[model samples]
Target: MWELRHRGGGGPGPGGEAASPPREGEAAGGDHETESTSDKETDIDDRYGDLDSRTDSDIPEIPPSLDRTPEILKKALSGLSSRWKNWWIRGILTLTMISLFFLIIYMGSFMLMLLVLSIQVKCFHEIITIGYRVYHSYDLPWFRTLSWYFLLCVNYFFYGETVADYFATFVQREEQLQFLIRYHRFISFALYLAGFCMFVLSLVKKHYRLQFYMFAWTHVTLLITVTQSHLVIQNLFEGMIWFLVPISSVICNDITAYIFGFFFGRTPLIKLSPKKTWEGFIGGFFSTVIFGFIAAYVLSKYQYFVCPVEYRSDVNSFVTECEPSELFQLQSYSLPPFLKAVLRRETVSMYPFQIHSIALSTFASLIGPFGGFFASGFKRAFKIKDFANTIPGHGGIMDRFDCQYLMATFVHVYITSFIRGPNPSKVLQQLLVLQPEQQLNIYKTLKTHLTEKGILQPTLKV
Candidate 1:
């Protein structure tokens, strides 16, 4: 069996000579030479024993907390087999979670942002815990503290950008916030620099490689969890529909695929996810596309879902009331000849947003599964069944959000590339933050351009 070599304090350095006592070391040093060489010499099979041969059956069962169901429910399900029992438990939990999700949605955008932030924190914790386990034998100083510090720094930066973008009026009301907003990037960088210095200071001789590995692991985790979650919030700001459609599409795909695979699966879809099958993939694609279309059509009719979330200074709360954009308005489309002949209609009225949902759904079905596969490969690399037992049926917050993050990124890109343009409201908000003279100068320039274009009377009074 493969075994990990544990090193004592003052272990041998590159040339296998007993090294001197530990001391603070440079962040970039020659220590990696020995570490890399040793890693190359180690047998891969020994390093991750049984990972190569482990099958789907190795997944762990439900914990005691989950297994102890209500007596009434237990009695109701007692006649079923173990498989059905598990299905019932998972189904019940899934419904409960969905109910909570709807409540969050009803509470409005701010609550949704809080939910994203909470999930980001949990996902970060789960991934960092794995890193801690891998290096628990080493007495790395200040590693955990610095990892969390970096997370705070990153969140500060991203959320600061969000505030500056969305809550301009609110920030303008506060003197302290104005200064912070003016130099937010610089402050964020300084905070990160402090954490970086702390990391370098915590590095010890003979543990340089492990310390660096942990550092990289912390950063990659932040990239996957924090950055992607930030994108999700940004999508929400675009309009709740932009956020809801993509997320719902992924959920629809996941559930429909599972249902289809559970009943009709025979051909394997991929080795990474053994349970995924061709039947599921195809069913999920069609189901998700149809769901996205209907979801978009329904959400588009409601200003609450289709309007961009904006702060209302008068009301002192965020509001989503605005003239519905062209994307949300019903537009006429000419049907193809074959379709017109079959349906006996020449034209169809639909919201433009519904058309965009097809693209979102297609990507969710095709590319989104790869995100779960990537997570699966990550688990297999560490020879673990799940990230954590945070959820009863689900593995961890990270596991539930793996595909969602990927979908979030694609939605953000799609909005920026296809849906969004220079926002007059955002520009007005930026101008509101400027000095009177600067604002006046821009006003005069815009007036001049308008006059030159014959769109405004040059002599009109302000």
Candidate 2:
């Protein structure tokens, strides 16, 4: 029993030198060895203790710093909180940015010029980045790089200063504008061809099917975006109905959807996008319709200033003393008979308030939400969460502008066909009652002038 006590005491046996407390260093080393042995024994005991009588407290205490449970949990919660805070901040910033962007864009023609060019370029870059991420995820390295460069070129050339100058010049004359549109078609065809070539060259081995689908999807999306943009520009819808209606409708829809979704959303609108709710859909629809009516009423009240103004010069052939600059001045002008007739017409007339407002409102609401749904479908198919995290609450450019693309297209078409009536140029030609020969002469004269000015080239079929 004494020998057993000496062994359990963790000291030398009795026959050896008398046991003494170790030096400081030796004592630490001894304690370490003992602790290590204790740890092993504890582990073994733990393995058997489940079937025995040992309790948790029997296990030796480790250093407080080594107790990782609270530390791990704290770290996890800190990271999550930080992410939440960042998203919150981002949401606020995005709201400000969007509000400012819309205000600047809707102010006037000059503002439209700056906003459209700059924002579209930024949007193109964002699109290219999204494409790169998508392609890279599938390990298509070639497409990842090729798409980036191609989009860069598109933003630089097609959407750059050259196109702006072309558009500005084209709009200066009706005949030149028609010619410019025809020219633009050729450029568009070239871009399509280039896009197809890049898609083909970026193909991966087993991903051929995916590549095909992606190509087709991209083409459709690009066509939609381009067509919408063209329609908006051609209508000169820079500030009035074109700009105001779509922007207001989209905002109303978004706000209504969020409010309803936050408060009353329960039933999922679609399984793919779990957050979207039926309540939100209904609320957004109603809101959009209400906003549309308000827009129409306001626009109709301000319709006089919305009409395009034309000026004509009247020259006195008998007077040879007129200065060249004086000849070009407004004082030398007489309002054309057409202009005089328009001036005589009643001004600032409001449309009769009718159910048309409700129809317009409902149409805007339905179509805009459909755009959002379509974008959601695309994201789900591609296995992407968001286009980007740029907007905080908004997601990305695609997210914010998705509904606008479709809404603008529908609004432009609707206004042109119903509210605006026949094309202005066609109506003017019809009203003038020119003979075929006279019309031909006018066309030839305009074409000749434009050709001589180098605005229309010999290669142009028109």
Q: Cα RMSD (Å) between model 2 and the true structure?
A: 22.0
TM-score of candidate 1 to 2 decimals: 0.84
The 10 consecutive residues of candidate 1 with the worst lDDT sum are: 1-10
State every prediction's TM-score relative to the real structure: 0.84, 0.54
**Deviation of model 1 at 393, angstroms:** 1.6
Give each model's whole-structure lDDT: 0.84, 0.55
Q: On a 0 to 100 scale, what is the lDDT of residue 273 in model 1?
A: 88
lDDT of 1: 0.84
RMSD of each: 7.6, 22.0
**Which parts of model 2 are misplaced by more than 4 Å?**
1-95, 117-124, 137-217, 235-239, 303-305, 308-357, 425-462
lDDT by residue (58-143, candidate 2, tens digit) is 33332121222234444544645654644445445557876886676446444554555454545555565555454443565455
- Tens digits of per-residue lDDT for model 1, 256-286: 9988988899999999889899999999999
User: Residue 313's C-alpha lDDT in candidate 1?
Assistant: 87
Rate residue 305 of model 2 by lDDT.
Answer: 19
